[model samples]
Target: MEKRKFLVVVDPSHERHLALERMLDIVTQRRESIANFHLLVGFEGADKADPNAPSEVIRGKQWFDELMAPVDATGVDYTVEFFWTANWRKSITDAAERFECDTIMLCESSAEHKRGITDSKWDLVRQARCDVVIVDEGTEAPIKTILAAVNTQAKDAGHQALNDRILERGKFLAEYFNADYHVVNAYTDSENFPDRQKISRMSGLPREKIYRDMGKPEDVIAATAERIGADMVIIGISPRTGLSAKFASHTTEKVMEKITVDVVALN
Candidate 1:
């Protein structure tokens, strides 16, 4: 199998390099499966400034070099690049495309209570072409349990494909880390409760590992994740626009607010 490439977005303002730490942990554990990493340091509102002319850029490079000393000692093949753009979401997505990365790993920066419409982190989640892992800064390394939240009652082809994608990514991570894997499905009413057998077949997990409840998606997901002591939650997110985007919050965003674990969002 070909090695998987990762685009790790670094925040210069954050005192803790959580995203880079998470990526390093993954590389340490799964060195054989990982390809070279590309680190993108984001400098928002610096689009007009020349890359080499700014004193901030020079200071940022010095800080970045010191931060990368440990990475260099590990002998992991990696490269660092900086981006100065007002449109952070576009810069991240474009870099992902340019590098042909399989996944984008970044720290969660939105407010814990609610994510505003202007939150670029959530926008990055919606805009990125590859799988995006939003790592909570407080999350511990070496994930112990993974909860794959799925909407098994959806009959449409698009949702079905998304459900399958969620399971595939979740199961891959579970096996890779040798962690416990569980599936959670929430239903709105009796008529639409998820089929246990279908979920079992789709997830390839036993009956005992499946969690089914009748409630709102965010509530069920948050409660189940808390109950299971999940270290990470893998959920699917569909891009929204226009009125839908303005009036409502995505289930993924709501779940992020309610839970403290890391989230892997598949588009």
Candidate 2:
């Protein structure tokens, strides 16, 4: 298997390093598949502190070293960098592109403020070219079950491509962790319900493992995930523009609001 490069964004404000922990867990489980990890620790204060100052740089390095003690003990190859800019959302995507990372990992707290999703996080999700993993609070290693949310009713080429990507990534993760893989499709009413054989053929899972229900996408995904006791949910996010981007919320975001499990958003 080809190794994957990961860009992990670490927020300095949060006490819990959920992203780091999740990355470490992945590295531990699939060491050979990981090429290297780039750790980006953000300190959002360009006006207050001199980012280039020796004292500040030293402090940031010290904090990073302390936080990475466990990572170092694992003997995995990684590089650490600090960002002093307040525009961390752009910085994260920029770093990912610069490093040619396949995926970007962030903690749930970094995406939420006061129990609400932040615009900055949504911007990163929409702008990022690579996959994004939002590590939820209290997420542990060795994920037991992974639920892949798909829209089988999609007919457009773009939506079809996204469904294929979701299934492919979901299967990859399930194999990586040796976990149960399940696919879910939501319908508005009985007339639009997805076909079981089509879902099974698309997901390569038994019919019994495929979940189809009639409801809003978010509600069905949340309910199905809870019913199956999934540890992580993988969904696709299509980039929006203009009025839709401002007025509409992505289904992935709505699912994030409803579920406590980790989410992997594919573009």
Candidate 3:
């Protein structure tokens, strides 16, 4: 069997360390399925002030070494990499592509009071080609429940594909933790939306566990997660404009900012 490869962004100053630890725990729990772990760090590009690029690479090496010393002791197949680029979103996507990573894991930074979902985090979610897990402050306790938020009234095929991705990822997590898995669909009009059975078939969710509620998508998903005591919620993310564009508050951003539990935003 092929081992799963995880591309994890390790930032020492931010709360991203929690995401690194969470990924390590998941690898330890499912060693047979996870094959390799690759750690990546992006640094400032060399400028007139700091013309030496190798210096940054060496510094990044030192940083990653100290961060992953414990994991090395555990004898996992892992590699460390450094990319000196001003564009973080591009650098991360490039690293994932180079390593053929199965999942790209990122630590979501603390959201600004008025602005939700930092620019860097949101950019990566939009640019990355593979599935991205935007981890919030994670919990030490085992995950007991997971909620897969989907859009049954998707206007196009791309949106439906994202919903499928979210459900598939959610199912994998639920089985991995042996936890309860539930699917939620919040639509504006139930008359035109697919029924519970159709959603189950499309999302691979059990008919009994599928929930069709009425309200705003983000609000309904957040409420369902709270009511079910969900430890994690998986939701699909849509691509936005380029990084240069102004940050627009989208549904995924609202959901991530409002949800209390860990959120996995599938790209």
Candidate 4:
């Protein structure tokens, strides 16, 4: 297994204190296994010096020096940078691209817009070229179990080549964290609930553990996490929107909101 490269975007909020600590723990534990580590901090550029003079840009170097005071030595080849930009999400995406990061972790910032027509994080997640992990910050402890909310492959659609790709990704993370992997294929009918057999077969999970639940996607994920005692819920992010609302099957913002368990969302 190749060590995954990670890019962590830090925010200026105090609530993010726990999130940063938790992130530090995860990175520290997997230091040896990480190929590259990048921490990016971005602050909004001043009004471009009255709109035409151009914004005062922070220099490229040592931006993270102050924040990384606690952990002097970050695992893997590490780099910290500071950027002054109007768009946080754009900065994150640009930095991740420049570093060729495989995964980017998003920490909600203190300056997060409470009521807005646009969501910065949502724009970033949807536009990211690489896998993105959207976090609410300072969740809980080490994840004991991760529930991967997978959609059934439309085998009859003639596009079901191997199996659901989400299944494989879910299994991979479960194995990576040494957490119990639960695959729940939901259905409305009690009779069809036994379709757990199909989900188990596809996910290579124990069938008896899968159950049928009829409810909103958020409800199902939250309920399953509580019932299964899962520490993290792994959901997918595809085609993110400005609102980033929990529109259903798999999305980052929704999973994070509905579950008390730490959410490990994947893109």
Judging by lDDT against the true structure, name the best candidate: 2
Give lDDT tens digits, candidate 3, residues 1-267. 345789988654342476678777776677677888888865544452565543423444576677788788778888877665667788888889999998898666642333356777787876778778766664444678899988767667777777778877887878777789999988777575657887878767668788878888789888898888888888876534555223423767888888866777777
Q: What is the TM-score of each candidate against the true structure?
A: 0.88, 0.90, 0.81, 0.76
lDDT of 2: 0.82
Predictions ranked by TM-score, top down? 2, 1, 3, 4
Runs off by more than 4 Å, candidate 4 = 13-15, 44-66, 73-76, 108-118, 153-163, 188-194, 238-253
lDDT of 1 by residue, 44-77 (tens): 6655455544344435457877999888888899
User: Which scores greater on TM-score, model 2 or model 4?
Assistant: 2
Go through the candidates in order and give each one's C-alpha lDDT. Answer: 0.81, 0.82, 0.73, 0.60
Error of 3 at 9 (Å): 0.5
Cα lDDT of model 4 by residue, 1-267, tens digit: 667777876654333444456557666655555776787755555454556532323333464455576656663466877666787777888888888888787654444343221266667656777766655443455655777775453333322322365577677767666667776544445444436677877778786566567765567777887888876666655433445334532334555666654554445
Model 2 segments beyond 4 Å from truth?
A: 49-62, 110-114, 239-250
The clash count for each model shown is 0, 0, 0, 1
What is the Cα root-mean-square deviation between model 3 and the actual structure? 4.4
lDDT of 2 by residue, 1-267 (tens): 678999998877677778899998998888888999999987555554565533433355577678999999989999878777778687898899899999999877642374445777777877789989888863567888999999888787878898999999999889878889999999998878798899898889999999999998889999999999899999888535576655435666787778787888887
- Which residues of candidate 1, in runs, are more than 4 Å off? 46-61, 110-118, 239-249
Pitting candidate 1 against candidate 4, the one with the higher lDDT is: 1
- Looking at model 4, the pairs that clash are 19-138
